[model samples]
Target: MCWQFPLLGIVVDFGHYFVHRAMHSKFWYEHIHYVHHSLNDGGPLTAYYSHPLDFLLGITAPVVLGWWTIHGDLKAFLVYVFLAQVGALYIHSGQSWLGNKWHYQHHAKLKRVYGLFGISDFCLK
Candidate 1:
């Protein structure tokens, strides 16, 4: 069913939140995630301008977690990938989603708010 997409999205959100928070640590932030952070202003292009490792660990790893959880459904996973891309572009554009201007705040302040959906922001932070 279409149900798994939402479940997968939630899984990815939490996973990404933790990975992103870790990326903000002293070493990783300066050496890796800083590439994304340095690209301030939260433009659409900012979404794609992360360090290779930052993209791998911060984005792909969590997506893989969700895909693995679902036991590897290629078609479904591809759909999730597309949606995640759209989300990345949108959030990086400084637009609010579900009441949170996520990447905008993240880029502007270089502080908290790491999750895609804001549940993790409220619950975890």
Candidate 2:
């Protein structure tokens, strides 16, 4: 699990970056991701405000793929997923836990700062 952790992280990073970026595109935004952005001043539960398909593609699929890719331990994978969801909740809650600025800025300018850890957005910038 230790060995697979970084690999899963990398896979999730790429998957999230691409899926999130795509969700912001005009068609997707209007139909799906915009539902998420509707709560401009987000709450703890804002992370789950998205369309069902948006949630599946933008959140669940990446983690599932990463787990599958690594043949991850079920317990460890569940823990990782729980933590990630909590992090996203914190981010959207505007609690200043970490990464709040990035996501808030994303709300400010919908097309920028699409990645979780900021690496992909930084490179794109």
Candidate 3:
């Protein structure tokens, strides 16, 4: 069960990476993800400030995937949700601390660090 937490993180991170990568596409970017990207100088509150479609794809979908894969383990689900929200806030806070600079780079450059864990980017690249 303890080990499952790490596995859950990997699964959720992959989902995030896949959806975030897709959101970069021209169609998705223009129609959905553009709103979130508009906040280049993002803050913590702006972390989840995105279009409904963007939220569905980039946030909720990954959560659902994690929940399903984890066999509905409430503890694991809560932990994932908590960590993901904190990570999102930290990344968007525009503060350079403890490797959060990657997300800042994503907002600044719009071309890199599409994953929370970098797993998808690493595997795909």
Candidate 4:
């Protein structure tokens, strides 16, 4: 929540970013990513409303990583899950800069916006 934990945050961020990039790739998009594109005018109700491939990449990857590396600490796992949900809410709300709309611009102009949220744009761009 604080974004203060260095190691876990870094690992999770990197994993989410990279995995998300793979999902946005031409191969994946040609098949699954577009299902989400159908909701460009999306809102709060649209959150988690993703295609099956999108859901697998965004949600399953974190759980798999936790199972593999975190030794099954339910607390840490739940925290990560919470943060992910928060991030998704903020990202998909069609807003980027808290109040201003700069971030959401990518959603309209850039087809992929890199990842589920806009976090991967810096790398995926």
TM-score of candidate 1 on Cα atoms, chains taken together: 0.89
Question: Which is the leading candidate under TM-score?
Answer: 3
List lDDT for all candidates, in order.
Answer: 0.83, 0.83, 0.82, 0.60
Candidate 2 local lDDT, 1-125, one digit each (tens):
67666677777878889999899889999998999898888888988998999999988999999899889999879888888888888888877755377788788777477777776666666
Backbone clashes, candidate 4: 0
lDDT of 3 at 111: 70
For model 1 the local lDDT of residue 1 reads: 40
Candidate 1 C-alpha lDDT tens digits along 1-125: 47778888888888889999999999999899888878776678788898999999889999998889877678889998998898778877766755545556667898688887876777897
**TM-score per candidate, chains pooled:** 0.89, 0.90, 0.91, 0.68
Instruction: Write candidate 4's Cα lDDT for 25-124 as tens digits.
Output: 7887667766765577857546677787677876677556734564555566667677767866776786656652533554466444444334445565
Backbone clashes in model 3, listed as residue pairs = none
What is candidate 2's CA lDDT for residue 97? 54
Error of 3 at 115 (Å): 1.3
Per-residue CA lDDT of model 3 for 71-108, tens digit only, reads: 86788678778878898788788778678777777787
